[model samples]
Target: MSGPHAPAQREHGPLPFALPRVTATQRRRAAALLAALEAHYPDAHCELEYRNPHELLVATILSAQATDVGVNKATPALFAAFPTPADYAASSPEQIEAYIRSIGLFRNKARAIHAAMKDIAEKFGGRVPRTMDELLTLRGVARKTANVVLGNAFGINVGFVVDTHVERLAKRFGLAPADATVAMTERWLMALFPRDRWCDVSHMLIWHGRRACKARLPACADHPVCRGFGSTCELRISARASDTDRTKSNQKPGSASRAAKRR
Candidate 1:
């Protein structure tokens, strides 16, 4: 048994499967893939609902520990009650907290939103800043939220966003190595896809993660992009089987088996 152990490998260069340095051919493939995904999800956009940057900032804050659906439920009343940055700047934390009580960590989000609004109103003339540096100045506005607003709202693609779904799919798609951090993942994705497609890529990848490449179980059997990635497809196929078992348990006894046969 002691003979079964082997020496660890070492390297100062790329990971064994680090997405081959983006060649012109690879870029072309990426472009075609992007085109297909864009066509498939033409309507894909930021899930957070907001009429303006200020609302987007607030909604993104609310979305920290809550789903976009839940945040959407909370924002209509919040946006109506405080229609302007100045309104949020002047409002008490108690007022903002009341509107967003349904979201987790409302108290902290209330504090961040109130402070950020005051800063925006006083320093930026009651508007959310379009540039990365200025946007980063707002409380709770990190690269993820800033990228979201700048890309979707202002059409400025400073960099790619690395959200939970993006992170998961990035790994599952073999776009980045297993140990990739958010910043590293962003760099990897930006390198692979074209600059203009960065924002849309996040949306498409997120949609895929939600509908197919889920965290717990990915539906690789039906995912068109599975094989292009690599061994992750194997992981997804297994996860898909696990999903089938759970699904079968919830359905009429023979229904799932029948469906499998038909497929």
Candidate 2:
């Protein structure tokens, strides 16, 4: 597909699902969903612990395959060891690795942090860059990390942050195509909400994802937005049905018949 309404494609092929065309009604519903989410998580903000842009950038990179809690646990000691961009730039990968060994892929993460800090020190005067373009020039910094730093640290809402939770929630709420890539999902969210609310939208969705719309089993029955949508929460319903089927299939073949005979 190619045009104003063309679906975004991956390098290998077109996305598996197509996004529904936007309408005024859908926009209204989306707005209501955002409002409900905001109300639910009025104190929503970045969960990652960072005192500065450099810390946030490093934490986000380490968070690629790790949890925020794990990242937080590792950062305090790491930050104390290397308190500034210059400090990180000066440290060897081995020394940096010692501080963040508890995080997943700590070796690679250490290298990325070292390389990124080196770029910051040499290229940007030992300060994290404020713009998306400059941040992208650093090692291991993508749109998601740039958005995290720019939005939280610099107060610049360049785009949405489409982590796994945001991606899943976007599809479940019918806001983005089911098979949308992280990049496509971000674009979809940017279009769905106003520019001013872009940062909050990411935070709110993340908060809801962590609290209610969990991956394996979402608590949609109690969610205001899900209830307002008037569907049976398709993901939860399907997951429950699948679990029931699996349980039934795993039973002994003649167990039901034996139970009936005994009764």
Candidate 3:
């Protein structure tokens, strides 16, 4: 009934559900979860190291499908090689690729960075755009990247930044419904948490997910957050178990249910 580990919020919506309304109980749980996370990880902040907005933007772009650790490893030389938007714009994508070859999708990312930087240099006076709409116009700059840049580079909190960790933890914490899409999850997170705390909310949830509430083999046994917040662990475990059982059942040599036969 109370604490960070509260009952999962039951969802109710129309036949073809869009974003379901946040319940009063879920709101309470969200507040509690934020408090607990803050207490546990007082120093939670963005892991992507950058000295400037352009650097942060570049790091964020490179971070797609790659870990922050990986991006950080490859960014120093890249940042030094092309210190500004104009620098990146003047350089070819092949040149950019040379510096960031260690990252995943480096070729595509190099092209994206080149295009985005060219737009920034030519249109925006070599400065990173502060607004969401302007940021979205640049290549590789979606809502998530825009949110990260705006929130971190500037002090703007237009929306919550939903990454893979935030997406998974949002459901497991019941801050958002299990069936909620990423967009809907962002909407729900914005509704539950305070507007000003949106940036901090992103960092805390991400840190928590990385440290304890990992995707595979979570530290639900003895981790302080897991110990204190144990209610949703069962739900997540059950969900994963169900998925595993279904996969195994499908792969089994000879197992056919009436549902499979009927289909």
Best by lDDT: 3
Per-candidate clashes come to: 0, 0, 0
Model 2 alpha-carbon drift over 4 Å, by segment: 1-21, 230-263
Report the error of model 3 at residue 19, Å: 8.2
Q: Residue 204 of candidate 2: its Cα lDDT? A: 85
Instruction: Residues 70-180, candidate 1: write the lDDT tens digits.
Output: 998998999999999999999988889999999999999999999999999999999899788888999988989888777766667777878998898778666788899
lDDT agreement with native, every candidate: 0.78, 0.80, 0.83
Off by over 4 Å in 3: 1-21, 230-233, 236-263
Per-candidate TM equals: 0.79, 0.82, 0.81
Q: Which 10 successive residues of model 1 have the least lDDT summed?
A: 1-10
Question: By the lDDT metric, which is better: model 1 or model 2?
Answer: 2
Residue 170 CA displacement from its true place in model 3, Å: 0.7
